[model samples]
Target chain A: MSEEIKEILEGLPFWEHLEKEERELLERESRKVFYPAGASVYSGARECLGEIFIQKGILRTYLLSDEGKEVSMYRLRQGDACVLTASCILPAITFDVEIEAQTDVEALLIPVGTLSKITKKNVYAENFVYKEAAKRFSDVVEALQQIMFLSLTQRVAAFLLDESAKNHSQLISVTHEELARQIGSAREAVSRILKQMAKKGYITLTRGEVKLENKEEMYKLLN
Target chain B: MSEEIKEILEGLPFWEHLEKEERELLERESRKVFYPAGASVYSGARECLGEIFIQKGILRTYLLSDEGKEVSMYRLRQGDACVLTASCILPAITFDVEIEAQTDVEALLIPVGTLSKITKKNVYAENFVYKEAAKRFSDVVEALQQIMFLSLTQRVAAFLLDESAKNHSQLISVTHEELARQIGSAREAVSRILKQMAKKGYITLTRGEVKLENKEEMYKLLN
Candidate 1:
């Protein structure tokens, strides 16, 4: 188990810069955990779930509104580390966001204090944390711009194109309800837009799936 | 002039953590620049301006849509450092947002390489950068939630209440167009909502200004 943990640490770019003592400290302190799909990993303002480094699968982070609406923020995939869940390091900020497993997942959890100690001693780890935070910050800003400036139809179209590229297919297997949650709109509104797109020959929609009928037309909607 | 710059640097929380040699290096390398109100500080994705530490006045960072609609992201005030403008350090991320002076501003510019070197060598500097980045990320996420889940009326009401608190008075001197931009809405839509709030006895509207008549009523709209 110790050898396995050391091997994983050695594979990470940031861990390469650490001294042998620091690497050994992290290997000894960090623990691996797993979650099934649909499991709640962390929630609320005060829970500090440590710094999570995803070893496999997907994690979805989102916000819940008083009206019971869910707005997807962003997702963490393999090799991505989430520092926001460890709010004890950021006492001035609140962590009201919820993190859930989108697939059966494995991750290494570094206790907040241990991560802080490693960062204090290792410049590479510190730089990695700042860069990741900045990247996530840019992602949130991009999402805000889309929500505020893009019309619902434009957003839906853009989302479809993005998902298609990620899946490497013209056909996307997502329900209208899931699509609506992804774009922070109502299911009825998403369904209406998809139906209109289908009528316009931009896409073809069926139960629990949508396929691009004309990729060129769909890309044009992005602008 | 050098003495004045040193005093400003000493006043900053991050500077205190630096070694004396690092502080002297910063004093020698940093340049102070001024921006008149309404002057553009930074724009476009290709321009990486370096780390900006605000010495005085306000800077508004916002996004511009293809149709020229403006959406306010956040603002930087005295003693605040903006890493968004220092995109060279975060090369994987794009800084497409525009930053403009909301008031006549004085700031210190540490060239990207210098700031990067300092952060790499100093644990305190790295921690400070990570903390600030995390805080800004949290701010962007909060704004995203508001735009996605809150109604325009509710947002306007919340904005009025927030402005009143910031100014420490019920009367806020801002044009409807400015308020509209702040909340990423149309001037006409903001005016209509303000008119409704005035009629409902929650606020009083005048040319270029708004007065909160019932703070309690405005707070109720937040829920």
Candidate 2:
């Protein structure tokens, strides 16, 4: 880890508590890899393999059923932890889904066994992992609640707003198909809704990018 | 707790490793209370409360949105722990949902403050709590995946199978309105599907009870 990326990792809730030495131990065990679009970083069961920190680019978590239906469970952005959310845990964690790079991606993959070794020897590491698990668990539950209760339009608006915040850019690169999978809707329906929102002046769409024209106006539709 | 219920609790992951005396402490703190059908045990925005162990009857967990729309999150049956699932360790947990008794009910409540104290002092207790949290987290995530990916009819069938297994009965006492909220659909739509399923001999429906006549056939539909 470079001084810059190490500083960022140190800011992360999970790694923040580790002593400089312990953090180095983690860094030593971790393998930094870059994957191009459509590559699988980890392809296996749903078992808790540990955690991965997204250093760059975008990843999508999806499940493919035996019949080949694709279900997009979540998308991973930079600074996100893969294992903390859903990767591999005991009691047989098989990913009915696969993790795919949406674009060129860089990530730090940590094995669960390595994490367990460190945590077992260090109280700080143990507490950090537990806390990280708790936080990620809450996020997954919140996402579940949102999907259950929020309307499709509300979901799209929220997703757009979140993406805008994350990138700090009004313009985000996404296709209708990807958006539909993220919000668990049909591609055609998402396209229609996006078109309608664009016509209403809340957003503008172009090839490979959508820009929010009026943030306040779009938020009002969240209700 | 009686010897019988104590045995049951001991079998649960949370109580499995506790010393007999330590287990007795939990038993002493627990008090059984009963509620009539249609009673609200806890409401939204309530503080992080104690855990509840269902001794008898069915309970529903649901959120009442700002627009007064009710979204059912999960159903709690006998032998389930409610407080463990509702803990607010960090990020300041808020009760987004209410717990309501769907039938005459009896449950044991364990205060969160006491559990916190126990966890701080007892390693076993802390481990038990963390493990329970992890398991519950997995359960909630699994449910979200189902909701996001599964077809409406598939979800309904799977829900019926789950309820049947929990209650150990073919007949489940759930109104169309309750089923609709659980599955995030309209009550009329749920009714239409149930009626159709009944006509096809998949289930038998009375005023408020539904019984699966053929579990195998229903499971096939869920796929």
* TM-score on alpha carbons, each prediction: 0.90, 0.82
Q: What Cα-based lDDT does every candidate model obtain?
A: 0.81, 0.71
- How would you encode candidate 1's per-residue C-alpha lDDT over B1-223 as one tens digit per residue? 4776777667766787788889878888888989999899998654778778898888888888888888887778887888777766655455488889988999888877788888778866766666676667766676777777789999898788877886589998889998898888889999999999999999998899899999998898887
For candidate 2, what's the TM-score of chain A, rounded to 2 decimals?
Answer: 0.77
Q: In model 1, how large is the Cα lDDT of residue B1?
A: 47
Off by over 4 Å in 1: A2-4, A16-21, A120-124, B11-22, B116-127
Best by lDDT: 1
Candidate 1 lDDT, tens digit per residue, A168-199? 89998789998998888899999999999999
How accurate locally is residue A192 in candidate 1, as Cα lDDT from 0 to 100? 95
Best by TM-score: 1
Q: Which lDDT tens digits does candidate 2 get at residues A135-214?
A: 55665556666676688888889999988998899998998987887776789989988999999999999987899999
Compose the digit string of candidate 2's lDDT tens values, residues B1-223.
Answer: 6775566556666476567676777778756678899998887576666667788888887667777677666667777767533465433233356778888988776677667766666655665555455555556656666666677788889889998998789999889988888777789988988988899899999988899999999989976
